[model samples]
Target: MYDFYKTISKTKIDIVYLGETVCSKRKLLRRDDWLEIAEQLKQSGKEVVLSSMALIEANSELAAVKTLCSNTDFSIEANDMSAVQLLKNKPFITGPSVNIYNPSSLKMLAKLGLKRWVLPIELSKEALSDMQSEKPKGVETEVLVYGRLPLAYSARCFTARSHNLPKDNCQLRCLDDPDGLLLSTQEEQKFLVLNGIQTQSAKTSNLIMDLHELINLNVDVLRISPPSKHTEKIIELFHKTLHKAYSASEANRALQKLMPAGGYCNGYWHGTNGIDWQETTEEILCQLS
Candidate 1:
């Protein structure tokens, strides 16, 4: 984990999200541990944002959210309303899990001292264009352009359910699958992944293909969600693609080699089936628009 942070810190990526965003039960890193990691990343000249959980069921979880919100050192990515309540009137970024869909929600959040926000994964390009036009002054936007899309969050632990064990006594089994446990269909096709309470797409969502549109839209940040492997190279490829140092087609080919098994999906960005991979081109973009 330390090595991963060190490698990412050296990359040209502007912001790095650390800490758990899905499950509060994850204990591989305690508060002090995350603080130490944040210190290391800051030392490497990387801006770090501690992420809050998507759900706050237990009082202990709410207390943890408050602690992250009250931190004086680094900024935070608030994922729940509880975090937002604690962070009101203070500069902070909202996470993708915050259910911000329309311009009204964006305007409301902006009024609450929101400096930036991650576009919800399911929002289409056209939808984003509308939101961008109506976006509040001084508010920036980040899009989830890579890695498996986080589909949903639930209170039940699907990983523990797989073993016929209850969520409370799951024995921290999710740690075994550092990335996530792959879920397959009856036909043996990989469909989704179960990471504790978070369900993610089985295929990595690659939007290096949409670099042109994102840049055209003036997106403030292009977030490359971390996968199980090849993250450093993936970051490099995306960086090159964004700068036109490499073409989208070339980057896509290279990405295929780097992530051979994890396939790619860009449907949500195209307003199609979330799992579908729609090849976008000048002609196609014209037709869609």
Candidate 2:
């Protein structure tokens, strides 16, 4: 984990969200370890935000969120409402899981100390623009430009169930599939991914082709969720594209090679099916015009 963070610190990415945002059972790193890593990343000139789990199902989980919210050094990314309540008026960012779908929700959160909010994965570009226009004075908008979309979360441990084991006694099977265990249809078409309690889109959500639109919408941050492999290269690709070192098409082509077998999707951004990929040629032309 230290080696991974070391590699990330060298990358062009600005913010690094570190924590166990999924199941609490995945105890490879404790709170102290996360804080230590956050400190290291901060020293390395990166803004580190500790992320809380999306589902606070237990007292221990709520306690963890409270502890993270209490940290004074770096900010916290509240993934659940419990975290938000704990972090009230403390100036924090909300992760994609918090469901800030409309301007009213955004306004309310801003009043409660939301400095930035990540657009929910399923929200369209149009929705973002509308919210961006009305978002409170100091609130920044972030978009998930790349990575597998975290579609939903469940209390049940699907990864453990896949192994026919109970949630408590199940071996840490999620560790076996780092990226996520892909689920496919009977026709062999790739579908959703089962990562313990989180359900993610099978296809990686790549929006390199929509960078212009994102910029036009005044997106403050473009998040690239780290995949299991080629993360550094992905960051480099985004940085280059953002700086005009690489054209969007060129970056898109390069990104395709780095992705796994399921291919890519940007349908949610187009206001369509979350698993479908929509071509952005016309949209890019419209934006340029």
Candidate 3:
């Protein structure tokens, strides 16, 4: 967790999101601890937002979300409607988990004091274009431009089940894999990653090549999910790409070098399967290897 925070700080990320978004069971950092980190980030002259658990199963989790929504030190990124309801009439950011597919939903949230929102992973450029054509007044759009695509959320803890443990008594086994556990098919082919209750793609979907396209679409921010390692490098590549200091080819190469195994994918941006890499070059693969 410190590694993740340090990477963001060193990279000079404009906004840093603290708190666990996947499972509440992973409690290396508590609310107060996260708020303290937020204060440190603010002291460094960066905007900080606290994120709530994506799946709010129990009242305890809901209460934690409420605390995050009510925290005055930083803005809240509402991951669910419960949070949105709590943050109503207060300025907050909408996380990608909140399905704001249409303009009406977005407008409603904007009316409720939503200043920025992250688009869902499945949303293509065409969908973003349609949504932006009627984007609510003063609502900034953010996209999950880089990272492993969070495929689905399940009530049952996949991480616990993998260890043959009951969900109620997970023994905090998820802490064993900081980056998430890799799952494979019967043929032993790597497929998806089990991130507590969330399933993510084995291949990290990147949009360095689509940076220009996203800029054209008027995307306000590009979110890069924290990876296991070299997160600072990924942030640098994204920053350079956004500033036009790095060419598409160069950024793509940098991304390929940063990720492991299955490599860079940008299919969702192209309106296809989220695992497909639209642009590939021999030089990139050589550098990646």
Whole-model lDDT values for every prediction: 0.88, 0.90, 0.83
Q: Return whichever of 1 and 2 wins on lDDT.
A: 2
Give the CA lDDT, 0 to 100, for residue 240 in model 3. 81
With a 3 Å backbone cut-off (N, CA, C), the pairs that clash in candidate 2 are none
lDDT of 2 by residue, 138-228 (tens): 9999999999989889989899999999999879989999988889999999998999999988899999999988998999999988888
- TM-scores of the candidates are 0.95, 0.97, 0.93
Model 2 root-mean-square deviation: 1.4
lDDT tens digits by residue: candidate 1, 117-157: 99899889998999999999999999999888999988899
Off by over 4 Å in 3: 280-289
Candidate 2 weakest ten by summed lDDT: 280-289
Give candidate 1 regions above 4 Å deviation: 260-262, 281-289
Error of 3 at 245 (Å): 1.9
Model 1 earns a TM-score of: 0.95
Per-residue C-alpha lDDT of model 3 across residues 147-174, encoded as one tens digit per residue: 8888999998999999999998999998
TM-score of 3: 0.93
- The C-alpha stretches of model 2 lying farther than 4 A from their native spots are 282-289
